[model samples]
Target: MGLGKQDRTKAREELAHDQERAERLPELLRSVAEAERALDEARERGALVEEVHEQGVRLDTALTEAMRAAYARERVLVGVGGYTDRIRRRKRLARPEIKQATQVAEHLLTVREAHRLHGIQQAPRSVV
Candidate 1:
């Protein structure tokens, strides 16, 4: 069956949105990279725990947004491919970005764990 007018309109809108997102992918990736660098620098400088945590949060948000943009860009690519082929292509396109994000996340987790340990060490011990 042919698509209804409303369906066609919605599809067009979605395509347009995906195209915009594809155009923005580079900027989003740059933001993610910048946030990751800032977080790394904060850790290296031994900044306040709160400051490091804030940086980590920023990195997390940037990474999430960049990932969404990447997925959107992938969706916008039209070609002759089976489902598995498309899935493989998407994974290939995303692998590097995913690796970078994973590294940042792991580093943030380590920093958080260290902070938690430090807090525990600073807490006063009560004698039973």
Candidate 2:
């Protein structure tokens, strides 16, 4: 059967609604794109923080190992004058390595904190 006048009016109304939604498609797409970009940035920041922390841990471990070696060298030199000089030279060499490791670990911690703050700042706010 052919559509009655009421049916025809309902069909026109539905078509208009669909057209309106289609017109809003670009805006919706842009919003989705922005959300995705924000998510990507947050992930990148988190990764950077993790990387920095790992580096700090590695540096700390190296410093610990170097100190252990220096202590062992000192203990072995207890009462010999000639060997005491060798121990001093070994300690002097280890001192720079320890210092460098300490500096690098501190710097990495600072970098991690900065990245964490950046991630928090970039967090997307709800539109509600």
lDDT of 2 by residue, 4-107 (tens): 67766665564454445435434543553454455455456765544444444443433333333333333322212223245554565456554554444455
Which parts of model 1 are misplaced by more than 4 Å?
79-128
Give candidate 2 misplaced runs (Cα > 4 Å). 47-128
For candidate 1, what is the TM-score? Answer: 0.61
TM-scores of the models, in the order given = 0.61, 0.35
Model 2 clash pairs?
A: none
Highest lDDT, which number? 1
Model 1 weakest 10-residue run by lDDT = 77-86
Error of 2 at 122 (Å): 20
Q: Write the per-residue lDDT of candidate 1 for residues 26-90, one digit (tens) a residue.
A: 88779967987887888788887777777777766776666666656555553222122546555
